[model samples]
Target: MVKPTYSPRRRTGARANAPSSQRTLHLGGESNPGRIQPSTKAAPIDTMPITSDPALEPLHRATLRVIGKSPGTGLVLPQCHIASCAHVVGRGTPPGTELRVQPWGRQPVEVRLIAIDDNADLALLGPPVDAPCPVELQQLMPLPLDGQIQRGDRFAAIGFPKNTNTQTIQCEEIQAEYEFYTHRQNQPSLLKLKLGQFRPGFSGGGLLNLRTGRICGLVKETRDEYQNLGGRAIPIEDLIAFCRHAGLPLSHAEPPPAVASEQAQALAAFLQQLPKWQDLASRRLFVQWALLNHPHAGDYQPMGQNPAADAQALALATLGPGATDAGLDAARQLLQRVLEEPVGKATKAEAKRLLKLLDA
Candidate 1:
């Protein structure tokens, strides 16, 4: 993996968490945390609030503050085990490296690294037999492994940062969007999320599902800062595998039943008519309403017998990266209807840009 450079800037408003100048997430391209502009819109505030839930309060105790020059974060799990990022504690820093963790409301305790999954960027820690009881991790039920994480699902993360006051840990709640799946890549295919500003200590903690208040996955790394290329997590399935590999016992909440094929097909049918809704707002709102009504039914997968392919082409043409000439042409062809007809200025401008990208 390529390394990313972090350029420092003058400290901004309240210093809740300090940015790491050396530590950076390598995701194929240059990711400068300083390049991300502050967002004006509070998507989380507009959508839903996760801070009020007492169920998530236990997460604070589970969060662990690493005390060092480049202090990071970790979370407590069952069986006196602590989970964190391998990179945070030094991936190749040899086994049994001495580390100190300040558990919530407790004195600093010495712990040693026991296991590290380099591929998943996960590490497990356990205290010496003589050490005090570690903070108890909440065994909240997890979202089903087979369930789909949609475009606008909300989640919260709790972590200890060196920049913040040692007494108080901050819990940041944000609305996350599922961007894409990368299967052929070096890393495992993860559900990439788009979130608001998160601090350095946010790493190594767990990404909690807001609705279920369960630890969905470990917060792996953050990408292009605030441009919606937020952070990545070791999706729930991968997290389970890591736990099993480390011989940790975990109790999962009963998963909801599989989404029926008929329902998925019907939702696909409804989304296909979005283009025919006469206006972009109506089309977008209609799709949103359908998803709102059938939250369980996942996004329509492209198939031979369905209109999913056309819908995908239209979507890809309009919003996706025109990486290839053929893809650009296909996008241009699909977007011609909107361009020719009076859909709206914004829609027409987007269509023209897609076409221009193809020409370029």
Candidate 2:
């Protein structure tokens, strides 16, 4: 991944050799001086691994995974439109290259690229007419409309980091005054944040307020190690400007209440029950059982399609807060089956690890 330019320094020469991820050039406008780094370039887009029971939120339903030869992240807006970094959505690839969006617990949908403003480093994507219902945009918190944000305000971010798993960073801070990206034309304003050690693939995701659950900004870039691990984001005002310019409808809804703790409890119960689950579709069936039978049903969406790695994911999820009595009994049975069956070394090791956890 390319590091973003920092120090608020003036550009002395043209950046022709910079990685495409950092090339935030203005389209159809005069050049400006600033730095840019696309969030999609955080990992290889082609190697997206599937995991069962991702513990997604309703808000997360609107956060789509953008995949192509160049994979990235996108957010479903009130217009049923997907918003992402221009570099991520507009990057050129081989012929027939298409943008595929995978919503939480649903089939992937292909979208039509609508408008791209390189100066703002923003792109608007609309779903095809035949595509399934757009993600739940109403669950998202629209920023500035809810209230004013200032320095020291707490925030959170969720995105498909490394094109592998859904990861989140909670309790990030607004560290500096908002500023414009002077390097691109029109000089769009961006939010400055103190996000230490951010993961890759969070580039096009929302910077949601911790208190109100509203989206304050769209993550843009991260500074180098010398710059103390700071990051940049496109402020909500800029996002509004893009929507208006693209003629797309924008929603200004209040974000829902926080549900992290509730979700955690539900996940714990589901993981605890998964070991004893012996069915044709263990992951989905087990999670469904927990959601319906446990007290934490409101906290989580049921598990989606199961894969071979699901056993590993279930084992890992169980590590937090440990397992229940029923889980230990089920785990023992599962591990015995694995030991008696013909599976790979990795699977065998994973089974051993899970047995140890159950014993613990």
Candidate 3:
């Protein structure tokens, strides 16, 4: 397996040879001002070893065993073991070199080079020996359209944090903000997480949903105090892009085309059978799910008397208190259609009421 190397851009004049005492004397100074300071060249960063406890061994091994399968392939796994002080070395090494990752517990796993996005501190990993692939890549869950993640959600972190032998599995209630910034198109959005502990080895672990076991975010970083300092996970959407780029299989096992097609038909049929009141909510949920899990679903098209126009009108009428200014603008466009319609007095009255609330 080839390890990935990060070669930072060579800094100009940053590697000059040390000046001898004679040379220093010639400059009329005891120390050479041009010489790099020892502090500047000290070992990249100090890493702390997580305390070894027998209880954590299985979790650590389990995570490593699963992630270690693809030695040099850069597919990010749900379970990641991070050293206390691993620095993000830029792409400085040769392409095929096996990158040595020194996790806390077991032996160093030779990770194959996959892909590394320096801005995101995310690196894709291939399967390792004895590492079982997750049922899915964990990132296919639907994001709530409202963009709200409440506190107290149950979450788990799987990683080989300390060592290979120490599988420290940790689960906790989410408390603080999992603040995140994205630079995909130079447009950054702050995503806050609602759960989990930011333990040392859990850097690349998945922040998974307790209900469906789907992944919500990639474990990025945590606050130092572990108090209100919340841990951050990369959203699943980003993970999908990363995996696709790395060419890793999206699911642990591939299903036959017939089976997949049948599943899709069944879902559509089921939705069609729903009651009228349930239709909108069900369709909305389906649309959100399709957006993440089935990108091929095409764009969302509302259906009804006015179809797209009515859907937009409803969305405008129901803007939540937390709606942003941009969201409000979108609602206005939709509501305008409702106002322009020729309707009975009762219907028109209701529309006027909604428009009034929106204007307020």
Candidate 4:
């Protein structure tokens, strides 16, 4: 898929060679730089071979196997919206192409494409035009508003893994885990999936975090990492951004107060104030400000050093002397993540940068 251009004007020059995914563009009046666009590329299709239990019946039932020229999976959402990988219903698909969806144990029914975000590798689908959805929907999957996942967290992906020519997919539930974020050149934003084995046909299926029993992502593709095979997934943050940009309803809920408080503590107040914790621009601004503007001048408080906004000193004053390394280290790592891989300043619009800053 071509990289989505956020610029309001139509791209010319070498960009003309790239396929257009922005089916709907806002070109007049106010300009938005962070504006997300559509895509026209498709990925190889696959299924998330996961077994179902009584507790996971809702997820299994709500998950759908999308039938296009090829098959893929889709997740049912509130308000009759269906979320899936953009490639499953790529903009390049034939206009007259008939699409159908079949929930677990339910009959296949017609569906229509509504919108796509190639930038985010996400697509939104609805019931057939001028027709209502007739499927017996199950409990819609919910997204954790914070979109946080710790390494090694237990995960169970649910969707229809495919079968072809009499080959079968393992129908047993297996362990999967969140490992790391992967940013490959010219590839869609992705999260690394740590799993042993998976059969094909999982694309567009929900990546369920077993600990929270909530979907944290959608399985995108399988990857061969070194000799160890693994999987790739779209992050929940991208899904959230897609919903926000496409005007689709998002089913999300915040983590518990204690969990949020812990996450906040794991981050520095400076970074915590940013909308996306991993946003390079916002973090860069804060880092630059701390280095040049803050009284501390980028250094932690030392004996006889300026203690402006010094939390270590305050903690010592209140809780007595103790190791505060964990919190400070976590904050440093959070900052390092963005600084190491910044979205180039020359590439993004300043207004959109400010909006991300202001959104915090």
Listed in order, each prediction's TM-score against the native is 0.52, 0.45, 0.40, 0.57
Q: After superposition, how far is residue 262 of candidate 4 from its true place, in Å?
A: 11
Per-residue lDDT tens digits for candidate 1, residues 12-35, read: 011122212112111111122112
Query: What order do candidates take by lDDT, descending?
Result: 1, 4, 2, 3
User: What TM-score should be assigned to candidate 1?
Assistant: 0.52
lDDT of the candidates, in the order given: 0.49, 0.46, 0.34, 0.47
Which candidate, 2 or 3, has the higher TM-score? 2
What total of clashing residue pairs does each candidate reach?
0, 5, 47, 8
Candidate 3 per-residue C-alpha lDDT over 223-263 given as tens digits, one digit per residue, 9 for 90 to 100: 45254445555554455544555554332222112221222
Off by over 4 Å in 4: 1-55, 94-97, 138-146, 165-174, 225-228, 259-360
TM-score of 4: 0.57
Candidate 2 residues 230-258, lDDT tens each? 46777665666667767775645554443
CA displacement after TM-score superposition, residue 246 of candidate 2 (Å): 1.0
Q: Name the regions of candidate 3 deviating beyond 4 angstroms.
A: 1-62, 65-94, 100-109, 127-153, 159-190, 194-199, 249-360
Question: Which runs of model 1 end up more than 4 angstroms from their true locations?
Answer: 1-55, 129-148, 162-175, 225-229, 257-360
Candidate 4 per-residue lDDT over residues 44-70, each given as its tens digit? 122222333444544564576666433
Residue pairs in candidate 4 whose N, alpha carbon or C atoms collide under 3 angstroms: 21-38, 46-201, 46-202, 46-203, 47-200, 47-201, 47-202, 48-202
For model 2, the stretches where C-alpha displacement exceeds 4 angstroms are 1-58, 91-98, 129-147, 163-186, 225-228, 251-360
Question: Per-prediction RMSD in angstroms?
Answer: 15.5, 21.2, 17.1, 16.4
Candidate 4 has an lDDT of 0.47
Q: Which candidate is the best by lDDT?
A: 1
